[model samples]
Target: MNWKGVLDFLKEKKFGLDRKELVEAETSPVVPDDFCAEEVVYEMNDMGEREAIERFVPPTRSTATRKPPARTKGHSRGSMVDPRTNRAITFASAHEWRCALILLASPEIAEVYDQPPAITYVDAEGKKVKHTPDYLAVSRSGKKCAIAVKPSRRVEKSGIVDTLDRIKPILGDYADDIILLTELQLTHERATNAESALQAHSCRVQADCDRVAVIMSGINGEVNAYDVAKAFGDFPRGMNAIWCLVYDGIVKLANPALMLADHPFVFRVLQATSVAA
Candidate 1:
């Protein structure tokens, strides 16, 4: 059968023939294919070139079977973090790894140095861990990256061993670009594992932090602009400087963001604590 005749018939919607009769002709027959094609061409040509070229449209219910409407899945939810843009710093959470990052983004020391490199912390399981390096500093000589700072009392031969044990992977991975600082001094061998890290933290004490206190007090919150050298001092055979954690060109910090962001988590955390009280 001629598909053209069928298509033209569908388009013109001409089903029944014009021929009929009361009793003489008896009934109307389907239009002949040749006649239908001829009529289609004649009608189309009469409309001229552009009009004669038919447009294509998907078959609708009148011309073809229609499918039901499709079911659509909706979008997921968004974060409800009341913008903490200008909120207070969360000093308590400052001890936590991830939360401290918000504090680091605002470091005063950072201003003195180039920005910290993008940092990422990952666990042994290959899952990503979030940590703000404690310090990253730069000098004419080179760069540094400090992952942690242990109070002086915390330094022990074993302490350094454990300290290096835990943080070295990150420091080593981050090596040559940073200088890890701590109250405790360590032999190259001791600073290698978690056991050593724990030992280091154990030695830290209120007095161990006295040097840091002096330097910190002197900062006057002008970290990005302050002279870090004022905080600089020599350590005992095992004593470390306050800038110990300085790494690469950026001075990383436990709470850099607190020093950096307009709304540090310290104020926010304090606000929450105050409200709770």
Candidate 2:
């Protein structure tokens, strides 16, 4: 066998290959986690009597070959490999680092962090359609806050106004409360502009309305203030936007695509600040 072929074989074994090398070694590999069917059978003695027959046993899977936990992979995306006790700072793009931070800063939000957020109310045909938001986390005071999370990079085109329009009704009188959470990793000006437009569209007094709060991501750990302040200091990304609806409940748009809680970073963030109340 040629030396080239030997290298290829060793690469296929994944003995010491990096992620890129392993991927390149094989164009595609069977996904290990997918489950499939296997035949199971029962055995019986010639006696043919139920009491005399030996029970058929299915093959037992060996725990040694079992898949380990997700935490085993260090440096993997969304892995909370931070050795530190408090995760006040971390980097997460897939789960949008913003979602993790809000749950970190506000121990009060962990209550409804697990629920899937959905648009509870819609105004498509001048008629209200009721829908349960993905998150209906309750406050210590028995108030309900509607939550939705997405990357600031992904908040394109679907603008916050559209999101607010659909979800504003959750802030209706009957609703104990309505809270919108937006997490974006974008420029300070862009983030502020996007957020300011959402509530400003509606007038004041009614703007300061009740049962509704718009919460936005304050700042991502990736972009340090010094890096941002070199350009726009006072205008640094608002990071978190928590607004209590006063007027008619202003409208906003929040896409649920690519959102996840299973990530370790997300899990840890929620675990750290889990709402005690």
Candidate 3:
């Protein structure tokens, strides 16, 4: 045998023997009878029934009940994986995508479901209507909230507010509350911060969190996130730790504002559980 030729062929193909070796090895090899190739039936004398043969077939699978609507000429569509639940959520429009990220970034929110099951409710017109919310969020306290995302212009033009108003009354059946989010609430700063929180969550380290917790223990009053990050002496790791702390509820924004590192926040001293070993 050509040893060099065999090694060269193996390296080139990266799998199995070459044609020459395969032909040599299988030359006159005994072939087994096709015992189970065809479906077989067993005879039962007493039962008077033939035994059934089982065939391999993949079972049908389903997770999310509703899918995002198809994109029209003026609409947008996209998807993002929620880090909290490790589930992929599809958005039919940019507004819905923004809403998902904002919800995922909140410390109180535990899980987010996009295009949740439709709920039937009567509108002000006294007619039954089936309405599907953009997203449904579950809080840490186990409260569910149905969210509707729409542009301010469209909300006025299509009278979405009236529909939401009607849906709010019966929302207690499926959710604790119904919230209508508009572009005004989904600011650029919030979107940026939410994206940062998601990224920080992916690369979080326990050691860094412990260090940040120790630093926050010494804090009393409100402080800027940038200053907190500076206290750690390592900006990147410190900021990431701060975001992790925010998600854990140890750190909270002082008011309704952007969550950038430069923004003001107050440490939640009561919820300060040690993250150390």
lDDT of 3: 0.70
Tens digit of per-residue lDDT, candidate 2, span 1-277: 8998776656534423233533343432222111221234455546764343334333333112122224334322232211112122223243423343333223233333333333445565677655443234444455666544444554565454465566665466434555445443333333333333323221122212211122212332222212222222111121111121101112222221221111101100111221211
TM-score of each: 0.21, 0.28, 0.69
Q: Which has the better TM-score: candidate 2, or candidate 3?
A: 3
Number of backbone clashes in candidate 3: 0
The digit string of per-residue lDDT tens for model 1 on 166-235 reads 4556665454443334423332222222122222222333242344444544333334211232223223
Candidate 3 lDDT tens digits, 113-177: 88788888887678998888888899877999989899888888877788888888777659998
Cα-based lDDT at residue 257, candidate 2: 25
Q: How displaced is residue 230 in candidate 1, in Å?
A: 25
lDDT of 2 at 232: 27
Error of 1 at 135 (Å): 1.7
Better of 1 and 3 by TM-score: 3
Estimate the Cα RMSD of every predicted model relative to the unseen true structure: 35.8, 21.9, 18.0
Give the Cα-based TM-score of candidate 3 against the true structure: 0.69
List the candidate 1 regions with Cα displacement exceeding 4 Å: 1-118, 152-179, 185-277
Among the numbered candidates, top TM-score falls to 3
